[model samples]
Target: MKLKRTMAILMAGVTCAGALAGCGGSGSKDTGSAASNSGGLTELTFVMASRDEFMSSIEEAMVAEAEPLGYKIVSQDAQNDSSKQIQYIETAVNGGAEAVICLPVDADGTQSLIDAVGEKNLVFVNRPPTNYSELAADNVTYVGSNEDTSGYYQGEYLANYFKQKGQKEVKYLMIQGTLGQVSTTKRSEGVIKALKDNGINPVEASAPVVADYDRPTAQEMIQPLLTSGKEFDCIIANNDAMALGAIEACKDAGVEINFPIVGIDCTADGAKAVQDGDMAMTVFQNPVGQGKGAVIAADNMINGKKLGTGMEELGALDTSGKDYSDSIFWIPFEPVTKDNVADYM
Candidate 1:
């Protein structure tokens, strides 16, 4: 398992509201055991960071994959609430869930969750905690693609596209996700770095707007910017929902600027946006891989088996690190430009 990368390429895209795909339904807040099938399947609970399409996909994939592997999976929506997530964790702890796959509301805010998980295995999905490599433990590990890669890819593509057209100092409006989330921070840094490193002077069009990874919010937040006459040649949104929002906003204002917009997730809407030429590109962050991978890791953990042993085909499960306390597994991100958008869809 290796993360072989050219340090030379990829950065930013943001949040998810993926296709209406994947298995499983929204789980009850109740903590109770589902009767075991032919064998005593390990009971698992997934406490989601929020209730959205991407989270739903993760829950669905986990349930689908876990059932055959002699595991029962249930999920809870934290709705971006740390307190609610903690209460659910308390329920999971009391209900005797063999493992908990949590997507916390805040990446850095896990002290309460740590206290609640007790001896149960806590597998974080998608979002990594702040200073993760330093803070992660044997019981608390993360499974996700590198958030920076999406953004970096966006920046790299934009850099190359603009540079090729003999363009310089491309001004961009960055639509950010929730500020404190790990995805937001790393994606922001990574894309900006990619632009600078690629010999492109990416000027900020205006103050970055926080859309909270929602379309309406992005649309509302951007109206004022358009009215202010602040011009931007590109828009790098954290997620496709926001990127699409920017497009609609531009259309509504009847702005002559057909800004090149990029986003993350490569959701159905995002891909269509690319195909229809409403947006430029997006990076594919696979929920199925992440969901199945989490279930596989939990199965190994509960059985007292090695975590990375069976996960070779998914991605290199990086269980090794200097003074490592956790078994982390990383899924890689891929860029989806017009050149390759159809393959992803």
Candidate 2:
């Protein structure tokens, strides 16, 4: 009787513990329960800063990638406006989006997003927000390319071209992106450093002429550069949109593009220009990969899987931790000149 009583007591203890665990699992306060839902069938909203053709391509690609996985990707284009971006974020949150993928035009524009998401995840693509270290909490990852490295390559390519031609000095026109943006600043710095290294001191032309990544603005800006009678050895634009505009301006001025021009974002038009020898080269930022990576990271976050290989985890996408220093998801960048444009096209 004593032995049977002891066995009965042990079984009773195990049963009680299992019952307690079941109750805890059903409670809304369970953290593990929340983490497990992170990878489920989630509704994600991708808010881009503009409605340009590049972003359209990203949207199309993202739709194709998300459909098979049973996820919905709703896009909100802010048209380069900060207030509009904030509104879109609010809308996404209100609509119960599980995650948000943003391309903030201004670094500090998305602070409210962090507040709204709370435990939900947010992935900043293309541009990481400012002061992200303290802002990014448990569920956030940035997926994009290294702007400085790509810029360095752009600079090196332009510098080498100048040197190969044996030009004593090159007077270049720089059409930069918005001031204070990390992407714009880093790229311009790289180009400037490369030009100096090549025995060429470049004149910092107008304040990037404020093209706003629009072809019309770039075209208008370039017309003045051509009409001003200022001789420029090359027109180095921060993006292919501006470069295309410069090409149009060159055509209107009846000035043949003799100097080698350099640009970033090897879009379809950029590749065509390179093939025609109207533009020198472009650094291709793989938009397809950028979109796919963001979706994959969000899915992993939902699944409770760590953001990296077995040994690592990525922090917030902003310039914060040593974790993202080796983010393997970074897409590759390549210089596409006339030689390589044919293959890429």
Give all TM-scores, in the order shown.
0.85, 0.80
Candidate 1: misplaced stretches above 4 Å? 1-41, 133-136, 316-326
| Runs with alpha carbons beyond 4 Å of true place in candidate 2 | 1-41, 132-136, 205-208, 309-329
Q: Which 10 successive residues of model 1 have the least lDDT summed?
A: 20-29
* Best-performing candidate as measured by TM-score: 1
| Candidate 2: tens digits of C-alpha lDDT, residues 1-345 | 111111100000111122221122221111232211244645678989887766776677677667676677878888788877778877776666656788886777567666656666677777776654522244655666667666677778877887788875667787777778877777778788877876776775444576756677888887887888787778878889888988888898888888877788888898899999888999877676567666765665555555432211222233232332322235556678887786666
- Spell out the clash pairs found in candidate 2: 38-302, 39-302
lDDT per residue for candidate 1 within 1-345, as digits (tens), equals 112211111111121112211102211112233345345876688898778877887787788889888787767888778999999988977776656888888777876787788766677778877755422344565677777577899989999989988887889889999998878888888889999999999899898999999998998898788878777778889999899898888888886546688999878788889988888888878777788878877776666565554566654434333222234566778888788777766
CA RMSD of each candidate after superposition = 8.7, 14.0
TM-score of 1: 0.85
Single out the weakest 10-residue window by summed lDDT for candidate 2: 5-14
